[model samples]
Target: MREWLGWLDHIESVEDSLNNIKARIKAFADNGGYPESFAIIYNGEIAGTVGFNDVNKFNRIGVVGYWLGEKFQGNGIMTKAFESLIEYGFRELGLNRIEVSAAIDNKKSRALPEKLGFTQEGERRQAEWLYDRFVDHAFYGLLAEEWHSDNRED
Candidate 1:
């Protein structure tokens, strides 16, 4: 896990994640915007994380981001977690739109938003500096109206 996540060296350590959690919670409480992040727990273990980021209360929009441990892939865990977060972003947070971006070469990550019915908005060149080089990102977006219409229970 450490080796694979080396690209996220900016995080430095677990303590960084904890501090980020507290900051995000505080930002939400005070401004009604900011990511509502959570650990992805499965079977009493931490599998990964999923959350909404870059929340804009005035514009009613946010970006979604998530990751799952390699061991937990192919189990539909992230999809379920993302779906719940999407619902929360729209229904609970009153957000109008949610976007997701993944490294263009990361097929697995890129497939998630598509599987969840988010439209591929476009690609951004050199959107992320992974480790040594920049990586492009494929963007996807979904609107509250679109989500509700597609997910309406019969």
Candidate 2:
């Protein structure tokens, strides 16, 4: 609750998501989907969160999402978090692919995928209706085989 509240105070969309967390978790469980979520802790304090929502079992895919505390930004922490999530998605979850979408203007979010070598599939024009306007989004994806090969030494 404290983590949600802290994020809520500063992030408008996060504030809205806070209201749906409980019900969303319940729904995810009911649908046989694991709402893989975790909080980043440093010095025993919460620094950020990362998670997947609306996971589809048939397709073996999930949408990635995350946020970091302002103090933790631009330090490669979020990249580590994303790498952890992707590792879990491919290995533990037995997923074939992971997808992410970010507003075109969200440079940090968009850069994270490219940094991890995710292919930018395409842009969805006006796909996200956030902050009371339709904003374009860039979609990126990383395949399980790609991740697996990247880790192989031989």
Q: Residues 57-149, candidate 2, lDDT per residue (tens digit)?
A: 799997887888888888788888889899888877878999998878888778999999899999999885554467788999999989888
Write model 1 residue lDDT over 1-154, tens digit each, in one string: 4333434777888899798778878966776454488889999999999887578778999888788998999999998999889888888889999999888888888888999889998999998776677888899999988998895652
lDDT of each: 0.83, 0.79
Give candidate 2's whole-model lDDT: 0.79
Each prediction's TM-score versus the true structure: 0.87, 0.80
The residue pairs that clash in candidate 2, if any, are none
RMSD of 1: 2.5
